[model samples]
Target: MMPLNNSMLITGGAGFIGSYLINQLIVKGVNVICLDNFDEFYPRKSKENNIKSFIASPLFTLIEGDIRNKELLDDIFKKQTIGIVIHLAAKAGVRPSIINPQEYFDVNVNGTLNLLEVMKNHSVQNFIFASSSSIYGNNLKIPYSELDNVDFPISPYACSKKSGELLTHTYHTLYNMNVINLRFFTVYGPGQRPDLAIHKFVNNIYKNIPIEVYGDGSTSRDYTYIDDTVTGILAAIHYLEINTNVYETINLGNNYPVKLSDLIEIIEEITQKKFIEKKLPIQMGDVNITFADITKAKQLLNYHPKVSLKEGVINFKKWYEKKLV
Candidate 1:
């Protein structure tokens, strides 16, 4: 069992889901060490704002660094008594990964390798990997399961996540590390990343800008709410605490797929603004649909997603409008 006093090291803890996860854990009085590089992928100011509330909290420690920096990671592990490493750092975005496959692999795969190595050296065995449903990659299967063949990832981002999972499994096998790779679907909600479709659509509609619609708006995504995703992560941490010799790949998703056209409609209805639709050809790395089978998550973690798309979208609208002011 994990010692209660050990700090939980969460990489990318300032990003969308990472910030939310850290918030929840902080509320629960868990000691958290957040390691983030504040990448220019988005405005660093926004990410900084995400964690502003926790700046004064005694339980929170923010380390500004990259996952690829082995010396920094080694120093952190050497000093901190970290019970678990919840890895959320990665070069996100399927299209961007296609353009910069090398960078994606460097950060996602090589960076993950660096973390695992440091964890091994320090004997920090418990790990929760933030995987992606994009690994399914235009799968013919309706709802993706842990058993699905993920050997055919289409994007470098997806491939990188798959590689991380494989590396975790290798560590689990060799070092007896307890690892849980949670494949998160398209997570969205309040404080959603500016680049994500939901946030982008809402913002564009609010600003009277044309929102890009690719592939006749047929592409779909299983949008999991941020709160539900955090719940699953916490559950995984608990399971890891109580269980050993565990290596599991589970899906933490809402199990409902929303089409691109329908998603825009929802945003319009919520924000009370109609956006000009700019039609474009489907991008190279874009997938047709993503639907997750969360039976394993339910059985293992007792995870049940509580927020509906409409409710979550409404929450996001409230947050977005407040932020705009």
Candidate 2:
């Protein structure tokens, strides 16, 4: 086994998934540089708390900056010997993207371009990009696969993610960069983004506020646990190291799809509180269901998600109670 050295950069490192990835890498004795501008989509304090555990570790370095800043990225690329670039930074909400499409494009597409340009100039080849299931749009298919057509994105955020994947493909084809675009499903568990449904529902329940149920509460999502997502990412990293000849895209998600009502009920059961249900029309940019076909990930990356929704929710509720109190 190759030893992890001073050569891993995780963009959006202060955020939920990025923070978890950073910790995992650090535990493996890898020197990791985390870069994030602390976008206003969520409270900065939350992101700060997310990475608080790594603040004192010598192997961890946090660079408070934006990926859009080409000069800053160039300086970092020159200074550090980065072996792998995990691109996870972006303005991340789908509904917000509907109101401001340009902002989404600038941050998601242009920012990714900036990173790729810097990597190209520095001759850093390895990359793992964070793509989304939103790119699948409203496909009639039950479980989305990597081979599924992703041309029709319903929201600006989805379009931006799709654009990022395309740009990654371009870089891999032209610059010979070894890349893996992981299309993450609805990831939950501890350290989830406050804007996400699970977090919002938990917070609302704690505050004794109404939990909004949208679209007759039938919308379903492949609620993947954070641990499983991290496992998939680590597998991808190992897979890329061994198979450096090609670039690939894979879906990382729980095969099970949980409905909105069922999820809420589980939360209520965990909290032992009755939620004041506020039913509303499904918001735009929201999909009816998201189910990932992880066969490709299993075959290529040996990815297998272990945590079920019930187990994940119980774990999250315990954390939420502690944090809230």
The prediction achieving the highest lDDT against the true structure is: 1
lDDT of each residue in 1-325, candidate 2, tens digit only: 2224548989999999999988998899889999999999999999999999998999988999999999999999999998889999989988999999999999999999999999999988888999999999998888998898998889999999999999999999999999999999989889799889998998898898898788998999999999999999999888877776568999999988899989988988888988888988999999899999999999998888999888998898888889977
Q: 127, model 2: CA deviation in Å?
A: 0.7
Q: List the residue pairs that clash in candidate 1.
A: none
| Poorest stretch of ten by lDDT in candidate 2 | 1-10
TM-score of 1: 0.99
Those runs of model 1 whose alpha carbons end farther than 4 Å from true positions after fitting are none
lDDT of 1 by residue, 291-325 (tens): 99999999999999999999999999999889899
Q: Would you estimate the TM-scores of all the predictions?
A: 0.99, 0.98
Each model's lDDT comes to: 0.93, 0.91
Model 2 steric clash pairs: none
